[model samples]
Target chain A: MYQTIGEEIQVAGLFKKGRFWPSKFKWSGQTFNIQKITLTAEANNGGVKLRYYSVLASGNLYRLQYNRQFETWRLMEIWCEG
Target chain B: MKGEVGLTGLNHCLSDYKDCWAHVDINSYFATLIQQENPALRGQPVGIVKESGRTCIIAASKEAKLLGVSTGSRKDEALLLAPNIRLIPAQFDFYLDATRRLKRLFESLSPEVQIFSLDEAFINLTSCKYLYRDTHTFGTLVQTKIKQELGEWVTANVGISWNRFLAKIAGETGPKGSITSINQENLDYKLATTKFTDVSGVGYRLEKRLKAIGIENLYQIKLFSNQELEKHLGPFWSKQLRKMSFGEEPNLFEHIDSNPHMKSVGRSITGYKLCNNETEIKQILYNLVLETASKARSMGLAGRQISVYLSGEGRYWFSHVTLPSYVNQNKEVFELVYHYLYKKWQRSFLVIKFGVRLSLLKPETQINQPLWPTWHKQRYLEKAVDELAQKYGLFTVRPASLLNGQLIRPEVTGFLGDKSFQLGS
Candidate 1:
């Protein structure tokens, strides 16, 4: 199942080789430790570029979106596996 | 005499069946993508609309389809049918991204993949047959790879056949998430039962004509001679139909070129809002001309004939103009459109859709210098503008009139081809 949660979150990651790699993020009183990056795609929202990451954390997949113009992060989706 | 063989000859041809092409068609493409994006929406009554709670449904999920809500259904009607139905606005960028990922998967299997649409592709697996023992094995591999790589929700129905047309039919008629093959053995039986209209090229007009001549099924098409079919349908169409009916590859299909020259290129825009005035119509026409011209220019081709069409409230109007020289510039095409609109300027009905078509195309390298001095200057200026637009982006440079106009931004498009994501955007 996937849930839509458009909530701003604090992301702690390193910017290596001009790309942001998220190591972890705190969202809704819970911390998700990133394990691997599955897919990365870019989208343009109202002329502002946003980088979306489909990452695997704790054996579950989550969609994290980072706004380039606003310099903020938001948790977009969570794919929970049973 | 040998080429004129009938049922017996067709049966003999079955012994030489060879799997060459595989058509992969995504199920309920846009709706499936929406469901895949949000698993919560899966197996639910979902209708994808251009706008939430406003526009008609552009695509309906299988759940909504089961409830008799389909594309072009009004939002009110959909709500009445299924009150709990979810209407999601279309996200074209995400759909295009999924298409790209699917294309990559197809490429991993075969190098000769032709994207028929954003959700369908024809891959020639003739050269890669040695890698897999049979077509069924190869088809299974494709389905498994897509599910594992893209998503388990992203399923496809694949059809394997000797030609593109048969493969397409098999894909459409086959069970969802399964592989079906239409070879020479079952070609005659399939054609006997399949209606002529079910075939791709046979539209309503053609179906009516075929029915008038007592041609109802695909088998009837095989009985007609090429000359007889030509008299009924046009020469080119008759030849294609004959080839398809006989299970013989057309010349174009046999010698499939990587980049074939297009006979015509066109695009149509159907907006949710209505255009009630001439100025508004012209603004939309200008935007369409820009798109058509950009597409032609991108293909390194120029057209000598331009056609403009406007439709609203069951009324349709069209005008065609022929230019002295081949041109692929927005200003030139817009001038032709303006001339037509000036003569037929009637704000009677609210315009819902407008389109522009460019035909009689020739290679851009064959263009000759115009005699008029102003045209010469205009050509150079347009060339520089096109170069900048290609490099930076289409919206980087635009006409001053479009600055205030509420025109939709044109995306990267191909002539008679699928919409692809622009690189470096």
Candidate 2:
């Protein structure tokens, strides 16, 4: 099941190959270790360019958004596997 | 006929900016998007449903399609066919965002781009076609660009042709990663082999109608007189078929269209279960009204005609009427529909599906400014609400009556009926 969780989160990753690769994220007082970055896309959020990474962490899916203008990270949404 | 068409088509294409157009179609759109997001689902049979607990599979991944679990199959049937298949809910917002970025990339590559749908677009490469050497090379470069910029696993097919019709036909015929082209030289041969239904806009119903009249081949349609085809297929389609046969764009995207207007703004929903409750029905109707009106307002459009439709197990209800004044506000459109349309449907009808459409569209400016200051205040309030909705979400602020019920999510239509609404946003 998937649920909307649009909250600012702390994220750590490497900016490699001209793109950011998020490897870990902290949301709702819990840490999720990223397993793989399955898909990526960039979109304009109210004139701010934000790159999105749909990552798999602990067998669950999370959409990690990084705002380029503000230099902030947000956990946009999540899909949990039962 | 070929000689005449070749000469005229050459001249038309030479001067048309849409000359050497390329149709870019994402492969197995929804399924692939899901697979691209989840690592465990990659290389596995995947089916995308509208949401959890929904049974019908709207899309199937390449693996699932290869396994014979067809689209529109029940979840149970899909399990039987591919037991290990994963089912994911449709993520229309994600799809739209990705599509927007893809369109931006296409726009960067070409001067003119037409956003056809969430998964497809037509790129005009006439001015820059020479830069990539040939159509095939250009297509390959686009595929590479998609992989490099979008995602490594996500891929798209490129179809190049002289016109929109031929380009779309070429795009739909090839394999997921293949680059196909149709031009004047191969146009006749392609038409001879392509099925009537395979051509865009020719659905099964039209195919059955054509078959009823013994017209089997797309190329052979030219052999029949216009009167004979019109007698059976109606004049609009008869003309359309002739245009398709010649690979001519019938309308709209012939020029570089950035702000194409919509003929209508509509929203419809099919519930997961049959709903017989009046309150639930009203909520659904309200949701539909809110969406259609919001779309109209955002585009600075208003409609004088409102159509409401509903379907039960054995009955269908429809109402279409014109209002004295054009309306683009959600509350105004909702009141008209609720009073004239929904209220008339029998309470016990057991609605399985419902829809509302706002047509006879004109610019909001077409309506005269009302004499009341309250009306102007209401319009300003609505504009503020719309701006907030655009920034946050569609349902960021909604009626209290919809507080308990599940909010119906507004999706970007796959056919792109409202081009400016989806593409501009």
> What total of clashing residue pairs does each candidate reach?
0, 0
Judge the docking of candidate 1 as incorrect, acceptable, medium or high. incorrect
- What fraction of the real A-B contacts shows up in model 1? 0.05
Clashing pairs in 2: none
- What global local distance difference test value does model 2 have? 0.79
lDDT for B12 (candidate 1): 19
Could you tell me which residue pairs clash in candidate 1?
A: none
Going through the candidates in order, the fraction of native interface contacts each one reproduces equals 0.05, 0.33
| Model 2: per-residue Cα lDDT over A1-82, one tens digit each | 5677889999988989786788898988999999888777666543356688888888788988887876889888888665
State the lDDT of candidate 1 residue by residue for B302-325, as single tens digits.
999998887888897887888788
Query: Which stretches of model 2 miss by more than 4 angstroms?
Result: A1-9, A13-21, A27-30, A41-52, A58-60, A65-82, B1-18, B250-260, B387-396
**Candidate 1 Cα errors over 4 Å, as ranges:** A1-82, B1-19, B51-54, B193-198, B208-216, B219-246, B249-259, B339-343, B371-393, B411-425
The two-chain DockQ for each candidate, comma-separated, is 0.16, 0.36
